[model samples]
Target chain A: MKKTLALATGLAAALGLGQAAAQVSDDVVKIGVLNDQSGLYADITGQGSVLAARMAAEDFGGSVLGKKIEIVFGDHQNKPDVGSNIARQWLDVDKVDAIADVPTSSVALAIQEITKTKNRVFLISGAASSDLTGKACSPTGFHWTYDTYMLANGTGGALVKAGGDSWFFLTSDYAFGHALERDTGAAVTAAKGKVVGQVRHPLNTSDFSSFLLQAQASKAKIIGLANAGGDTINSIKQAAEFGIVAGGQRLAGLLVFITDVHSLGLKTAQGLVVTESFYWDLNDETRAWSKNFMAKHGGKAPTMVHAGVYSAVKHYLTAIKEAGTDEAGKVAEKMRQMPVNDFMTKNGQIRQDGRVMRDAYLLQVKKPEESKGPWDYYKVLSTIPAKDAFRPIEQSECPLVKKS
Target chain B: MFELLGVPPQALFGQLLLGLINGAFYAMLSLGLAVIFGMLNVINFTHGAQYMMGAFCAWMLLKFLGLNYWFALILAPIIIGAFGILLERLFLRRLYNLDHLYGLLLTFGLSLIIEGVFRNQFGSTGQPYDNPLPGGQNLGFMFLPYYRAWVVVASLLVCLATWFVIERTRLGAYLRAATENPTLVQAFGINVPRMIMLTYGFGVGLAGLAGVLAAPIYQVSPLMGSNLIIIVFAVVVIGGMGSILGSVITGFALGVVEGLTKVFYPEASSTVIFVIMAIVLLVRPAGLFGQTR
Candidate 1:
């Protein structure tokens, strides 16, 4: 990425543009990471995301095109208004060039509209709704991590193939949950599986037994959890008590992070098949990067969101250097053209619809006695290839995708 | 023989049972609030935090000292109650002479601080507590977990015990006398301040006990209390601010209402409690079991 950026910067300079340093606004390249810093999703993307962007800047030598690289972050608190308010302020008053890592899909979708109108870059590393790249796609936006479509295809498809065919969804009544359910439900239908029933519970609900009872009554072979964070943890915990699993039903965690597994411990989270794009213990490179991250993150492994933040920041800065300017359009084009190469992702492409097309892994949580040590949770089963995994451009609702 | 709104009778029975189980927590929590408001005349807004603290206390007890669920159930409440006694001495005691808002504000701010510290230390993903009784009996219509059944019974026993002590005993006579006229009670040689402080501690203890009951079900997280506290407040208000019997009954009844919402609409489950609270307030300002002051 660095070599490609330098070559592009040189080419742009030769093509009659000013030097990259002179093109930088305010003599600095600023990137802002917006996410939930203080709520239920906090542990997944909160301060750790901020820490990730900083690590990214540091790893990138803290500068691009002879301009200092700066990172700023804010807490959305899982509220869309709060997220957009902070974002508008960052763009107008603070002169932030690009916004990265807005999780909480409702908040992410809101920020998407604002950043589009503002004509600034947006890099999404959180929020699982496939709609970000679907109807809501923007020219300046780039989805770097996982999304609902990939999760539906990865976890949902595999479960159906495994004879956990009949489905019942316990959805969180919000944008992310709705998107996940719709996408996963579609995946089930495509695979000749029947959806028994679905119940949309409010976010942050403490009790899930009533919903679990309804799911049990549906008598579905698989209970597809279309929620994230605390909602997911509670559903799984309560399902155990209600004898949902003991009664021959399987749980499919559509979007489970390592932090969730850590919180749940191997005791309850064991045997749960989850789909995610990145895992820290995947290879030596991931381990080396994660160890440094874990040191700063209180010995906690990086969730895919954290890794996505780091990768997105590094790529965004590279794009700016490559384009020889901080303009949103040129940099975004450069980003889309350059393949995403990092520890967790290999040759990941940013599709025209802003979906980061990358291979995702299907993981099953090892039982309590599977025994390596703490944080040694997942047994990687198979990789869901990028072309086969992501929603094809032909089927996209995104206006950016040219209809053939 | 019967069906209500397209839901089967069997499913309805399961939902009703689930609602009753949820009501157990509400009854326990609102009962604490009523006790404190009835005696202290200051709304104990920290009830949720006290409950969260109780769960955290239980988690810590098991993690650090090898204390089991049974032991933590007894000790977590006492520890949190002792902490509550400290709160009464240090901060809440100073606001008894002022308007009710003062106590509410102080406790609300304190709740933020307490929750903030816990969030910083523990993070919000939540820690899991092992269920003492893991397996359940299949009731044919629904699976009934032994632990959940135990939770309902335990909360009922606690509520009845609290009501008996406050409304029936000799100590209860003096407490009620103090509630009416603390001056006369003090003049009659009763240590009114000490008694008031102990009453506050006891109420907070009830919140802690409810927390222990919830820990096994919901993962122990800092924001766990905040999520349910608003609804619990609605439960208390609809039950009539300081009515013990009112809070106890309203808590359970509202839980069933919320459960039905989850069945029919599902989206309005969180709001149904407040909706009921609004209607109840308009119809009977003093609540179902509350006497007009």
Candidate 2:
């Protein structure tokens, strides 16, 4: 009886070992692309970010460490509670390894906290809040595409240097807007520029005539737009109509995207100086990848957020393959250790505070005559190197940095 | 150099002008809603969607047929009004005997469908509509865009003309009579059903006209109406439903109030209208202009 029991136990142990081997060979990696899919920010990040992630997965040979990569997506509707709920579900229930392209600063910050608690990865691409790296930085969160600090330094500094010394801000009244306004105001001040006056407008305001008039009255040399998406488009369009630019007061778009330029068209958006981390037409690599992306996305060029999603996903997968495990902590560590080299970033490295250092560009919206065709919108003014573009690590004020 | 209420004269006058321009839109939209509700006894929740359709149609006309703003101004209303007629005949006609909530629900559902379809086709990014009348006259105090001035004037003219036809004409009397006693009007050998349908169409046409005027000022977007419609509804409520002159006056007055709020306490600009709405509801439940049934 004892001999028979020993043989049965050995058989069970061998079976368990075999099952573990099978699990190692057939692991699955899941990522969730969460953002405002149906609301205002939908045009900037929505389904396009999903398509970009899918492209990244395909480019990464569809798998990492012999595990098939799967992509999932959800619409946060630009609400913090909704975004946090989805992040919780994606982490606890669905076992999603990462969440990417979260727009709307409030939603992104909410998800960032949830991701930290769950020990999951968050690749923030669309949000522009500097606080993500500042006081609220999470070890599990990597701010990928752009941030308010970069925008303020690039566009605000450039505008100040170009003789737009006096400024008035048409700020969108929210966390994102406040951060942008504060950062740009600081940048303007640092460059010896003065902010004469400012007015805060509600988010998604349809009319800007009154706001523009207020800015016009300030007689500030520059009208700094600390807004994004539809708000930016409306303000720029109305500013033109009010002859703010022709009246000799320039407009500086602190967080303008290529998609906004397309919406406004070169005729109305001409000569508007803006800043971004990536432009599709920056080089052959970006153009080729964007062409592939555009083909799948109904001829809409990939915005920096979409490109950032692609780069983040590809880099995350590479990190997973190197780490040889989908354990969130180890994968995040690997991701930070490795340099991000892709179409979107050149030798970009994620800092201890999880801010991805990347080059930012100052771009001027091309005049109608200068644009060759559709999506030909930007005239690259100058490139701010990765080191100079992002906020310095010593000033990040991140809790994680102190621990590290 | 002078300041009024701590704001520069240019800023104050400019905001007031802006407020008036916004008021023009509110007046036009609420006028249409009042006209439709007066006779149809149906609250058209799809008004905003129809308004959005007007802008989209104008854009399509410009893109496909090379129709300019002037052509679109005339043609879009007629085309959209025809669609309104179809809606009244096929769907709305069935809901007359049911609860009024049914009409609201149906129209609301239709708006969602229309907005969804447009979002799918064009995405949410706005398409720019060229300002037909570019450049503004610097009036020393403020820079007044010709296009903005044109919108205010056009909307006012249209609203007044609508009010005149409804309040002062034989046709309007017949329309009022039909609203009061449709069966009696039908007994008098007048086609009451046809008149009701045409009135709804005309009401919808006013919205289309507003949309066309709005295309240049705001981005031509599927969401343009949805955003403006909520504020317009508040204006309609504050003015009292089914009151023509009340809607027109309240809309303009509220816009100026909102503009002043921007100059004084900018944070309250959005909520000032709602605050007034709450006060009006408490003071006069039927609205400033509406009569109790």
Candidate 3:
């Protein structure tokens, strides 16, 4: 009985120490980098996000409050249940104060719920669903980078205005695709264009002949592809084979990355227009950072997701330092109130709805014979200012907002 | 220029023909899965990776070995089949007595490893394989691409030939007997273990062959098979787990249904196959043509 009592006392002391470490810890501020390490999003954000986060930590001098800052990471495997469980573990056991760089929207939504429940901060950098800041907005969450609305408004609105007015969509059949189609369709209508018809293709569809034939038969001026990854590449390639492009119908890729354009080669993907929040060759700073990033990562260019990771991590750390505490509510308030400053971002501000205000660039894929160096795939035709790139705050459906 | 149900004859026929082409792939893949499950009693989860590897093999043969598509079409499956044999002998054979779930887990792990290694080497972007037969013969309503026609015909021949070998041959009789009672087959002085190994190898080769055919149409990538395999699995279960011809028929039928769904209600195009599987389970319990045994 005496030994048992002594053991219980020792356990209580250990528990007390753990609580003290979590609450009044002086040496380290822990941030969780939750993302898909080995799934579809992996190519966009996986190890590169981790490296980018580490670079941010290093840029922050690796320590804050006379203590070191550390990042803990886990692969959610693109499942919401797994992602939520990981977030819970990170918050409760790992004592993570902030989470960043969640790529999958479903996973991001699940994690946002967990973070909101736990009163922990979440900095979403990679996921593109507009719901992050719209209906699912949280006081504890800040969507730092891109979203579907920005993409649709930037590309769709611009393309519609450019006289590719009539559209026939070949969309992937999924939540993301549905959302993109809806947003882009609205943008097209808003810009005085019309959708002649639309066809839903299965996600990761190998063949696009049927869908392409539908688009061709529609005789629409524009063939809008609301898909990503392999589906987009295949549709565009087969469309070329079917002589659809030769028939004078333009192909608009709503969501495309530099990597995909590279894979398709400029010859095939030429004249395709896309909108992005960041590019590696934008300016001197972007080029310098990208050159180092590419050199470290085997000469592969950094996609928007990679750049977002770096910028988001840097901003989150700056917020954490400004707040002087790892508390989510406190840090989130400071994040919104403070101007977001980073190498990739210039005078960006986080709105009350947690949407990070930034410019979106419209790029046209350069032809192979354009006589440029390697990785010079895009020619920036226009830059959509931050205010115009995303849907206005008045149009947002977030319930959290009150019309003052 | 005849119009039917708001779709022109050319467009409707073209969609139907595309549906048939997709059906061929579905039939071939599910047939291989059913054959593998029939004898090995293990769901080859790495079937997709093996399929992807087959395409990569064809690409590599062309890029490095100076071999063309026709040669790679024959040699790639053999090379992939040899790899399958080695995999079955070394790793898969060890799980013969455990719960079949272990085999699924092992193969799932192998799939991740194979896909990861490929992704590490080739990246996630699709690498285009040049179409060996580029031009198409102009049909009345539609232009039938030579590669598309070749794929449909080749998959049909392979599927029918496999059915013949399994249903009509005496060797297949012994294989079926072993599936029923391995100990009895062993007692009859037949090599049951070797048969099991060879069956897995053959099933994997079928997936590899499908991959080679798909390489020209779809870019050669590690992810080429992962998505298709899930739908094929649903096809297998809906067609009755171990029924060979049921899987083949169901695969083609479901593909056509999916294509039609795209034409009518495009929203359900991705989900129509799963919906049909759910319906089949509710109505037939053992599938449309599947037997309970």
The residue-by-residue lDDT of candidate 2 on A1-404, one tens digit each, is: 45643454355346553232233222468999999887778889999999999999999987555456899999998889988888888888887889999999988999988988878889999999999989989988999999999999999998899898999999999889999999999999999999998999988888888888888878899999999999999999999999988888888888888888898888888888888898999999999999999999999988999999999999998887677667778889999999999987889989988899999988998989999988999999999998889888888789878644
Worst 10 contiguous positions by lDDT, candidate 3 chain A: A17-26
**Which regions of candidate 1 are displaced past 4 Å?**
A1-18
Clash counts per candidate, in order, are 0, 0, 1
Estimate, for each residue in A99-152, the C-alpha lDDT of model 1 and write its tens digit.
Answer: 988888999999999999999999999888889999999999988899999999
Clashing pairs in 3: A27-A67
Model 2: residue A301 alpha-carbon error in angstroms:
0.6
The deviation in Å at residue B284 for candidate 2 is 0.8
lDDT of 3 by residue, A1-404 (tens): 56753454355346553332233243358878888776555667777788888888888887543345798889998778898888888888877878888976777888878888889888888787788888888888888878889989888888888888899999877666777888889899988999898988766677788788789889899998888777788888788766678768889899888888877778778888999999888999999999988887878898888888888777777766666655668778878888877767899988878899999999989987883798899989899899998778998887777766
Please provide, for model 2 over B21-126, each residue's C-alpha lDDT reduced to its tens digit, 9 standing for 90 to 100: 9999999999999999988989998899889989988999998999999999999999989999999999999998899899999999999999889988888887
lDDT of 3 by residue, B139-231 (tens): 666667788899999999999999999989999999999999999999999999999888888999999999999988887877888868898
Which residue segments of model 2 deviate by more than 4 Å? A1-27, B1-3
Model 3: fraction of native contacts: 0.40
List all candidate RMSDs to the true structure: 3.4, 4.3, 5.5
